[model samples]
Target chain A: MKEKIHIIKIGGSLIDDTELLDQFLDQFSGIKGKKILVHGGGKLATTLADKLGIEQKMVNGRRITDKDTLDIVSMVYAGSINKNIVAKLQQKKCKAIGFSGADANLIKAKKREHAEIDFGFVGDIEKKSINKKLISKLMKLELVPVFSAITHDKKGNLFNTNADTIASVIAQALSAKYDVELLYCFDKEGVLEDVDNPQSLIKTISEEEFSNLKNEGKLHKGILPKLENALSAVKNNVNKVFLIKETQLKNHIENHHEGTEIC
Target chain B: MKEKIHIIKIGGSLIDDTELLDQFLDQFSGIKGKKILVHGGGKLATTLADKLGIEQKMVNGRRITDKDTLDIVSMVYAGSINKNIVAKLQQKKCKAIGFSGADANLIKAKKREHAEIDFGFVGDIEKKSINKKLISKLMKLELVPVFSAITHDKKGNLFNTNADTIASVIAQALSAKYDVELLYCFDKEGVLEDVDNPQSLIKTISEEEFSNLKNEGKLHKGILPKLENALSAVKNNVNKVFLIKETQLKNHIENHHEGTEIC
Candidate 1:
C-alpha cells in the first residue's frame, strides 16, 4: 500500500492576507501524514513591480514577462514572501523547508515557445522534472516542502510559472509513488451555479458536466484553467481533487465532505 | 575516524563578479566528500538599497541594520543571489539546496541587544541552533546546501546575519559528526603583513601572532570578525581554518597547501 501525500496549493490572495494566512497555516499544520505546500506569488509581486517602475508587457490582455518582471518576481516570491511563510510555519511547529525550482533543480523548465507571445521568462514545468527522490527524502525526515512558483532552466535562467500548473504536474509525478490528493483552495465555496452567489456550491464536477460547462461558455476565464488542471490530474491517477473555499478549509480537511470533487 | 565536511565561506566581492563567481563555483564543485557553501551578499544588496533610497544607518563608523535594510538584504541575498548560485551549482551537477535560517527552523536566532548601538534587525544565532541532523541528511543524499545570511527570530522577523559567523557556527556544530574545515574566501591571498603588498602573505598565524597584529591595529575592520570567527572555530575543534584568495581556490582545494592557516 502506498502512503498518502497531500499536495495543497494556496493562491496569492490568501497568502497576502495576514489573518487568513495564519488560519491556513494553523489548519495546514494540523494535517496528518506526509504533505507538501505549494504557494503562489501574491499581489505583493505586482506591488513591487509597480514600485520598481517596471511596466508590464501586455498584448491582447495577456501579460508577457520580461527580464525586469522576472527579477522582481524572483525577489518578492522567492525571497521575502517565501521566507515569511517558512518562518510562520516554523512558529506553527511544522518542519517546513522552502524551495524554488532553482534550489536543487527540483523542477527544471524550458521557456514556453509560442511565436505569437513573447513570454520572456515564463516556463512550463516539464514532465519528469520533479525530483521525486529528493522530495521523498525530505518527507522521510518528516519535513514538509513548501514551494514558490519560481522555476529555472538548467542553464541558470529563472522563470515564472503558474502555481496551479505546478501543483497539477507535481501531483501527477508523485502519484506513481504516493497516493496523491491535490487541493485547489480559493475564496469561492466551490464550483458555483451562480458565479456571484456564495451558496450556489456545486458539490461535485464530473467530466461530462465540465465538457457541457465548457461548451456553454459558462466557465469564466479564471476558473477554466483551474478546472482543466484539476481534470488533467484526475485523469492522470491522482486519488482526488478538490476546489474549496479558503474559509471551509478546516471543515473540508476534518470532514472530508465539503468542496467540489472532480472525477 | 570522522567523515570530512568542507564548509567554504565566500565573501561579497567574489560573488559580485560574474567571472570570479563562475571560477569559484567550478573549483568548489570539484571538491570531494560532504560539503556546504556559505555565501555573503555582494554589492547588489547595497546597490538595490541605494536605488530604493533606503539610507544606511551608520553610527560612529559602524553600520547598523535597520528594519528596511534587513528587508532589502533578505530579498537580495536569500532570494536572487542565493537562487542564482544554486542554479549554477545544479548546472555543475551539484545538487544544491538554498536556505535561509527560517527554513526547517535550521537556525534559531535572538535579536541583538547592545547598550551602545541599536542594530535594529541584526540577529545573533543561538548556541546549538544549527540543525546538524537536517544538514547531515542533506549531505547523506549528496546535496550541497547553500546558505544566505538571513535568520529569523521564530516570531516571524527575519534578521541580517554575517556569513562568516554562520559558517563558523555550522562548522562547530557539525564537527561532532564530521571533520570540518572552515575556509573564508575573499580578495587577498591571505592576511598580508604589509596590507598593501599582495606578495607579503602571512602563510600562517598563531594565537600569539594574532594578538600582536590586533594590538598593533594592523587588522582591518572587515577581516577582524572573520579572523575571530576562524579562531573560535579552531578552539572548538574544527580541524582547520583558512583565509584564502578567491582566485587561488582551485589550488587550495586540490593541493591543500595554500591560504593562511590559523592555529
Candidate 2:
C-alpha cells in the first residue's frame, strides 16, 4: 500500500477571512500524515489592483491576466499570502514551506493558447507539468509545501494559473506514489441541489451524475470549473477526490466523509 | 577538504536595473559548483509604496518597518523581485529555487528590540538562526536557492530583515560544512578610500583598518553595516569575504580577486 497524502485546496473566501483561515490552519497542522495546501488568490489581489488603479482586463468574458495584474497577483499570491500562511503554519508546529511554481521549476506551464482570445499571462498545465520527483524528495524531508497559484514557463515567464487545476494536476501526478486524496475546501458545504439551500448537499457525485446535473442546468456557474477539475482528478487515478467545506477539514479527516465526494 | 560554496548577495540598485540585472544573472549562472544568491529589494518596494500612498516612517534617522511597510516589502522583496530573479536564472539553465526565511522555517528571527524606538516588523538574526542542515540537503539536490530578505519570527509574524546580514549569517552558519565564500555585490567598485573615485578602491581591509577608517570618519554611512557584516562572517570563520561590483562577479571568480577582500 502506498503512503497516503492529502492535497487540500482552499479557495478565496476562506483565504480572505483571517479568523476562519486561522481556525482552518490550526486543524490542518494537526493532520497525522503528509499534506500539501494549495491556495487561491483572494480579494487581496483585486483589492491591491484597485488601490493601484490597474484596470481589470477581460476578453470574451474571461478575466485576462495582463502584465500589471500578473505582477500584483504574483506579489499577493506567491509572496504575501503564501509567506504569511507558511509562517502561521510554522507557528502551529507544521513544517510548512511556501512556493510559487517558479521555485525549483516545480511546475512548468504552457501559455494558454486560444484561437480567438489572448489570455495575456495565463498558464495552463497538465499532470506532466508537475515536477513530482523533486516534490516527493522535498516531502521526504518532512516539509509541507504550500503552493500559490502561480506557475512559470521554463523560458523565463511567470503566469497566473488556476489553483483548482494546479491541485488536480498535482494530485494526478503524485497518484503513482501516494494514495492521494484531493480535497477542494470552499465556503459552501458541498455541491447543493439548490443554490440557496444548505441542506441540499450531495453526498457523492459521479461524473455521469455531474453531467446529468449540468444538462439539467442545476449546477451553479461558479462550480463548473471546480467540478471539472475534480472529475479530471478522479479520472486520472487519484484515489479519492472531494469538495468540502473549509470548516469540516478536521471532521472529514477523522470521520472519512464530509461534503461531496467525486468519483 | 570541504566543498567550496559561493554565497553571493546582490543589493537593491542592481536589482532595480533590468539590463544590468540580466547581465549579472548571466554571469551568475556561469558560476561553477554549489552556490546561493541572496537579494535585496530594489526601488520597486518604495515605488509600490509611493503609488499606494503609504507614508515612510522613520525614528531617529532609522527607517521603521511598520505593518503596511512590512506588507509592501514582503510582497516586493520575497514575491516580485525574488521570483523574477529565480525565473530569469532558470531561463539561464540554473536550477534556482526562491525563498523567504519563513519557508521551511529556514531563518527564524526575533523582532528587533530597541530601547526607546519600536521597530515594528523588523527582525534581527544571528549565525544560529539559519537552518543549515536542511539548506545542505537542498543544495545536495542541486537546486540553487535564491533568497529574498524577508524573515519570520516563527511565532507567525513576517519581518523585514537586512539582506546583507542574512547573507553574512548564512555564510557563517554553512561554513562548518562548506568552504564558504561570501560576496556582497553592489554598484560600487569596492570600498573606496575616496567615495567619489572608483580608482581609490582598497584592495583589502583588516578589521583594525576598518575601525581606523570609521574613527577617521572616512567610511560612508551606507557601507558601514555591510562592512560590519563582512567582518562578522570573517570572524565566524567564513572562508572568504569580499565587496565587489555586481558586474565583476565572473571576473572575480575567475581571477580569484577583483574587489576589497575583508580580512
Best by lDDT: 2
- Writing each residue's lDDT as its tens digit, candidate 1 over B1-263 gives 99988999998888889888998998888888889999999898898888778899898777899878887888888898898899888888888899999988888888888888888888897449798888898778788999999988888788888889999999999998888988999998899877788888999998889999999999887778989999989988899999999888779877896879999
- Model 2: per-residue Cα lDDT over A148-241, one tens digit each: 9999998999999999999999999999999999999998999999979989999999999999999999999999999999999999999999
CA lDDT of each prediction against the hidden true structure: 0.88, 0.96
Q: In model 2, which regions exceed 4 Å deviation? A: none
Chain A (alone) TM-scores for all candidate structures = 0.97, 0.99
The DockQ values of the predictions, listed in order, are 0.77, 0.91
What's the CA error at residue A103 for candidate 2, in Å? 0.6
CAPRI accuracy category, model 1: medium
Candidate 2 achieves a global lDDT of: 0.96
Q: RMSD of model 2, in Å?
A: 0.6
Record all residue pairs in model 1 with backbone atoms less than 3 Å apart, i.e. clashing.
none
lDDT of 2 at B145: 94
